[model samples]
Target: MSSQLLSEDFAENIVTTARTATGDSLRSVTYFTRSDFDQLYLRDDLEQDADLNTFVGHEWRGYRETQNAYQESELGQCKFTVRSFENGYLLRVAEDRRGVLITTDGLSMQSYEEIAEALKRMLQDADDEEA
Candidate 1:
């Protein structure tokens, strides 16, 4: 990875960009691999919810079934996709390897779409960090 890309500035940029679309709806990031839930990232320090992880599991399965839909798009390269639920959306990253479960709440459909767009760029920029 490039030294500059690993700077705090880059990380902060991605976080700021994600918030632009997510607003207050972004709740947490539920990390997972193919087998099961792994880790999580929350907007604030708080108690973890078991049920939320359960919901993400179901959503990830549904995403696997519909993977073809996003496969041809730019986000597909990294297995990047978004799934909307009643409250928020899930941004799936590196589906074939490490997967991410980005959750949001109280966001409008437009916001969800916005986040989807921003997410792709964020992932790309984030990948630069790993390069």
Candidate 2:
């Protein structure tokens, strides 16, 4: 575990919540802070040795940029971001300097919203605890 800000139990709980909501289609769950990240869960079929450092760097930058991404628009602050791939979807939710990156197989739009809302609340709760 590469955790620095998140407790092991809390990180696992985050993964559990995602898994329960997304079911078997959930591919991976990663908990990340501004500078470090932990892979809480990954499906057995995937390669474990992939370069996560690069990915984490990209995600951290994305999280920071998203904060002010749409300040001039009426859509409000970003609740989350979803990136679609040919095989699956990547959902990201961030609060303050921490976030969770969830990857899952194709799921309904409702499923994505449900999980994103739940994760946003959880991340906000965690941020509140830190404050």
Candidate 3:
């Protein structure tokens, strides 16, 4: 589904999920694709971001490229990749269903199940909104 079809609540869930993971240090979810992602989404927030917003004639492809690239590499299928940030670790989940789950480094073990459940529902919400 295109980002344009995503709802306000759906977008808020992204922010809320980030907050719930570690409570702070989560930056924005930039839907960068195969093009100049950083510049396009710099001023624009998640809610307003869309695939139709083109650079020249082609629009920014969004996360599909990154997701696909990860799948193609020798690294193989990744359930999750966590990299440390100044405040926390960035969790990238490239599943059959896709999106990022940001969190602090100190997020409790107890929170994993809860975050997973919430992410499942959030992706569903996005899918429903797209329809």
Best by lDDT: 2
Rank by lDDT (best first): 2, 1, 3
Query: Which candidate model has the greater TM-score, 1 or 2?
Result: 2
- TM-score for candidate 2, please give it: 0.92
Off by over 4 Å in 1: 1-16, 35-40, 43-47, 51-53, 68-95, 124-131
Error of 2 at 5 (Å): 4.1
Model with the higher lDDT, candidate 1 or 2: 2
In angstroms, give how far residue 98 of model 1 lies from its true place: 4.3
Deviation of model 3 at 58, angstroms: 20
Q: Write the per-residue lDDT of candidate 2 for residues 40-69, one digit (tens) a residue.
A: 889999889978789877987987887767
lDDT tens readout by residue for model 3, 1-131: 22453445555566667566645434444332233222111113234443433521121223345556786778775444455657555454433444543444456555654665566566666657667
Give the TM-score comparing model 1 with the true structure, all chains together. 0.51
Model 2 CA lDDT for position 28: 90
TM-score of each: 0.51, 0.92, 0.46
Q: TM-score: which candidate is best? A: 2
| Cα lDDT for residue 98, candidate 1 | 38
Q: Candidate 1 on 3-122: residue-level lDDT in tens?
A: 222345544554565566676766775545455664434667445655865766676676676675665787544335566677556666543433455676666666655655665555
lDDT of 3: 0.46
